[model samples]
Target: MANIFNIMDFLWAPWRSKYVADSSKSKREEKCIFCEFPEQNDDERNLIVYRSKYAYIILNRFPYNPSHVMIVPYRHISSVELLEDNEAQDIFRLIKITLAAIRKVYSPDGFNIGINIGRTAGAGIEAHVHVHIVPRWNGDANFMPVLSNTKVLPEDLETTYVKLKKAIEDIINNEDSLDH
Candidate 1:
């Protein structure tokens, strides 16, 4: 009975977040799902913009909020330590630019940026190491995610994507001028 209870606890662990109640990881949904957003022509759904030789930035489809973005290396390396020096530097640069893009688009009060390494560490796709930059505001926390188990996104994903894409493009194009 104790062993069965321990198994149940492990199975239902993600629900402790209150926002994510469904244990979908075990169903292979949170496994090695790699997405090639830059290669696709659909910029709206894929939310890709400002691709570089070593890294690319894309908006998260399931965002924590509007204008949430992620910076990913072109190579699908799972660990940050495994990244080449050029890839490592380029990835962080993209992340900084993406944060600026999000700020220019959404004007959020703050941001939450992080990377989940393994599946147990909340990496929905553990095969890829991507950094998430989530825009946040004061009182962004609400009851919808807590009570109904639904994340209440403020704006349409497409609209947010378009706005962010343009901001990133402007930044990249004017980067040289902004350097001064």
Candidate 2:
């Protein structure tokens, strides 16, 4: 008889290979993605939606849900306590902007906003601190993840990125107009 769990292991989640491979690399060998992404010029290719003075918002390449993103500071620091006052403020501001943008785009029933500080605490990139904002809908926690150990996202990353990018830009522009 074949073990169901063994069969499940062969589930075709090709996109997860990068995440699995990266996680296995030693700290000395791996570059901080949060730090390196913003340094690049291609926002669309990098999945970066918005940028502020001290922080930026980037889509999670491996997402728990559609339109999931992280608010990351430019400076690579592992802990919340290490954040400068300005950086902290910028991150919080970006969080608000991101929430609004997500609402405009996904209209999720709720959200899971969090920061994992260390490897033990579930920080995938423990060397760089960032905030994950996962949009949640009613009954989103379905059988796929529990039964098959997989999450089926309805929207592709590129489409989600385009919609979110436009929403963020529009929201920021509106806020700027309101302030002026």
Best by TM-score: 2
lDDT tens readout by residue for model 2, 20-92: 6776573657787788778887899999998899999999988989999999999989999999999998999
The digit string of per-residue lDDT tens for model 1 on 1-180 reads 456656536423232463243335523565333445655656566667657888877777677777777888878788899999999889887877787777777788998999989879997666788888888999887767545767778788778767777888898888774456
How many angstroms is residue 22 displaced in model 2 relative to the true structure, after the best TM-score fit? 2.4
43 in model 1: Cα distance from truth in Å? Answer: 3.5
Error of 1 at 54 (Å): 1.2
RMSD of each: 5.4, 4.9
Q: Which stretches of candidate 2 lie above 4 Å from their native place?
A: 1-21, 26-28, 176-180
lDDT of each: 0.73, 0.87
RMSD of 2: 4.9
